[model samples]
Target: MSTEQPQSGDPTGMAGPVTDDARLFPPLQGRAVPVAQDRWERLVSAVDIPQPPEAVWAALTDPGRVAHWFGVCRGNWARADCEVMLDFEDGEFFWCRIQQNSAPTADHPGRLRYLWRWVGIGPVTSVTWTVAASEGGTSVTVVEEAVNPPSDWRSWNGMGWPGILDQLAAHLRTGTTWRWPWRRMGPYLQVPLPAPPFQAWEALTAPGAVRHWLQPCAGSLAVDDEMTVVMGDASGCALLKVTRLVDSGQEFPSYLPYLEFELRRPRWPAPLAGRIWIEPVGLHESLLQVFQSGWEGVGIPAAVVERRILTGYWTSAAARAQMLLRPPGAQAPPIGPHGWSLSGGDDG
Candidate 1:
């Protein structure tokens, strides 16, 4: 069934208590709350299908059928202690151990519970899928909980469901799933920060943060403020407009705060955009990153020159910014999200 909206028997709001400690550093909707005792986050959402319970159950349990919806499911469903694999097209996959599974019945319905995990993004998240027969169709609920997952992961997994459920419903009605996997390619940089992320956050968003790390510039740039950055380097002087400010938005507001800007490149036509992502690595340290993409707008792509610019400028500058933000004796944190090449890929 398609993920339509709130239906009867659906979870109308968040489950679990919003404990007192959780209120201190409030979580963005469907986001992780690290300040609280439980470092993990919880997300609950539901989808309605026009088919009956057994159809939904079949679409879920049958390996060949499930493959058309999301990831391909492998392993024997008949074995109670079997290990199932969910492999996507890009070779990225997750392994899950079936915690519980009930075949759909006339009186009640059915449910499936599994513990899931993947590489790059670590942390085991318990996932639960419940299906019940309703008046005209079936209602399905999906719940995921992970302890201290990477901020982007929490957000990515949470936001990626409805579309998947869409694929499920489509595969049930038609024959094939609609979407595939892809990753953005670009010169990316990550810099370490001092203890306590909030303190590191100040260094990222404080007035002139971009100018401090990026280039010497004109315009009054500051946090909670928007301005233009005018700078020059080997590539020549260019202007960038801070298009939007999201203090702590997306998957990891606390761990990853953001500042977005649009590059005004008149010569190269495609829209050039950049993002400054601040990610807290541990309670004592954080990582700052810079990324640029949208090279498809250009006739002659100078990605090598761009990589030199990113590493030569931002990488070195981010190191300097780290010193500026950290205490004198504190060790400099490492940089990464490694394997990002100056040489381009199709993901621009």
Candidate 2:
């Protein structure tokens, strides 16, 4: 991964030793994190494939060849105004409508444009793929732009860009594919709390209790209520409505006393949903589990939902509640998304 300078007459920006801009643009170290900007954020990565742009373009737009490097692409790119679904190796899926397919010719590079979205009906976020002939190879770039960027835009695409472009490079070089690994690790938490299930429910549904750990509370949380949760680190928010509240343990299936929520945001085409189920295990103790479902929906971007933020927001909130339920001067356990600890007096 040594950096090289661009040679004279080189159209491919891939030639030079990558500069600081490479981290954001492309040809970056695989581990570099995406940097954020006001109103928008950019993630750029480039690779020098020893083939011409035409070959790269074929691999990119060809449905059969795409799954080799990217995800499983469905639909006919050759068909005008075709709709495509990119089911990623990680089980995340994207719905895309082709707007322009500027095929590559011997005299000109190829340009393909699409209206990409999390669901069949959400924001028309732009995703453009460009391929150009370079000094010794082809230069390819994947650009995604959200006009009204979601709060977790950086988390959704920024952190995962390098690996994506890397897979494309490997595909060109050795025909390799990628499988998303977080499916087994995301948005799931099991932490025993020192407080009873009722007390934990109060913190979760109380008007402003979520603000302490998750985000600033907006609106109310009555059963069948609708509210907004704002991000503390960014200006984005998720709009949600509590659709059901089951409080009868006797009649409730599996010790029922759970809550269901349907999430939405203006401009997004699909719905996101979540649930929380509580189970008591001991006197003044409870087993708290937070389940963030509805990811199977195309409306919510996999990047936005398949994270600790959506998955762990409540887990972290549960941690905060554990702190609140304990007496003053009690210490907080060093629990994590996958860590486990009993609900008891401070062991420290």
- For candidate 1, report its TM-score: 0.46
- Runs in model 1 lying further than 4 Å from the true structure: 1-37, 74-79, 152-154, 158-160, 177-348
List runs of model 2 lying over 4 Å from the truth.
Answer: 1-42, 89-91, 177-182, 185-348
- In the range 1-348, model 1's lDDT, one tens digit per residue, is 867565455576332244555777665667755663335678777888889998888888888787777776666642356776675543235667788888779887788888865521224678888889887899888888865555565456646467667777787777775445443344455445655556777765565665555454555444323344322333554456666666654445253467777655445455567887666665676666666666555444564454444434444555556666768777655534321211111111
Considering summed lDDT, which 10 consecutive residues are worst modelled in model 2? Answer: 339-348
lDDT of each: 0.60, 0.59
Query: What does candidate 2's lDDT look like per residue over 64-126, in tens digits?
Result: 777766667766653458877775533234667888888777677778888765423223477
TM-score of 2: 0.44
**Positional deviation of residue 325's Cα in model 1 after best superposition, in angstroms:** 23
